[model samples]
Target: MHVLVTGAARGIGAAVVAACRAKQHRVTACDIDASALAGVYAEREGVDCVALDVADAGSWDSVLAEVWARQPVDALINVAGVLRAGVTGELDPADVALQLNVNVRGVIYGTDAAARLMRGRGSGHIVNIGSTSCLFAVPGNGVYSASKHAVRGFTIAAAGDLRSHGLNVSLVCPGAVKTDMLEQQRGDDRAALTFEGKRALDASEVADVIVDHVLVKKPLETYLPGGDQWKGKLCTVLPEVFLSSVEKSREKGIRNFKSPQH
Candidate 1:
């Protein structure tokens, strides 16, 4: 299979690329940081490193055109995203736009572009990297949560629409992962909820599920750690009842953030 993964320079995206290559699948690794992408995968056979800004429609067009010219992409994983932590009342307009553009719009653009080509091919898979935040509200990362909610909603609808075209769309929602993104949230009290997870997931752990399971089974939605799904669902259905627990989790997260072990 030929796979294209955005945000392939680091974190879960990079892990996915490595996992795919380990399976001997052809991969096109894309990232906004072209230099870093090239440094990471340029010398590796069976991996094509491309510079991509997922928020820009034109960039998507160009990247897909070049990729298709070489080989048909069998799977597209939309892993490119951004998060800006701010409470609702003090939110920065720039942060809101950046999060929405990169997280929500980026996923939409990639999914649309890939689905168009896949529709013509008569079969393909689209996997979107979502967040646990989509299931409930995160006080500090409201915009990021909203963006992920948009992704989850859009992925589900897109799965329904693309099924008739013989294409599959899947959304993977994971809790806190030990990545640069999580590290960025460590010091911010507003981002305390993000650290509530007992332990952060390794990027490879999530990638294993994507490549070993999601790509093979093509499930419409999957939650990393499995337990998080039920927790998120319960919170969603009865947020008022869970308010106290949420506060407790936030307190725990703050402690986790401050601990050297975290």
Candidate 2:
């Protein structure tokens, strides 16, 4: 399968590129950081690199055109995202907009481009990388969580729109993966709610499943390590009980692990 991955410079995106290449799929690795991608995959087999800012719709259009000129794209994994961990009043307006633009606008633009390029073509997939925060509102990351929540909403609606026509759209919600992004959150006291009781997820473990599902079979939604999907659903139906459970977990994690010195 031919695959296009955004946010391919590092972490989960880079891991997905490696997994796809391991499977011998023709892969286009894209990121806002072109130099970082070149440093990692310049000599790698079955991989081509492209620079992209996923927040820009035009960037998606231009790149998709270039990619289609060579061969039809079989899958697009929207992994480019940003996060800011702060108390609600402490966040800057710009930070909030960046999160919404990258997390929500990027996915919508990518989905539209995929539809334009691959719609009704009998086989194509759009997989979005979302967060477990999509399931519940974490204290330090209000707008970031809202942005992920928007991605989840868009995925379900887009899947319903495209699934009958042989195109698939899905969202993968992951717990905190050990990455630079997670590192940024560690300094924020409010984010203890997030780090509470959760082990860092491996990027490859998350990436490999993405490759498997997008190419082999497609589900409307998937949560890494299993059961997160149910957890998100329960949050809606049982809001108070759900929140109490999260608070309990946070307290337990605090008791067991001391916060690292900054």
**Candidate 2 lDDT tens digits, 1-262:** 8999999999899999989988899999999898999999878888999998899999999999999999888989999999987677688988889999999999999998888778757779889999887887776678888999899988989988887778888888888787778777664566766677447687888898888764577777788757777877788678787767766776654553454421
Model 2 quality (TM-score): 0.93
Model 1 worst lDDT run, 10 consecutive residues: 253-262
Tell me the RMSD of model 1 versus the true structure: 1.1
Pick the TM-score winner. Answer: 1
lDDT of each: 0.92, 0.83
Off by over 4 Å in 1: 258-261
What tens-digit string does per-residue lDDT give for candidate 1 at 1-262? 9999999999999999999999999999999999999888868999999999999998999999999999999999999988889997999999999999999999999999999889997999999999998797888898999999899999999999999999999999988887899999987999998988778888999999999999999998899879989988998899886676878888899889866545
Error of 2 at 153 (Å): 0.5
Candidate 2 residue-wise lDDT at 156: 89
Candidate 1 displacement at residue 171 in angstroms: 0.4
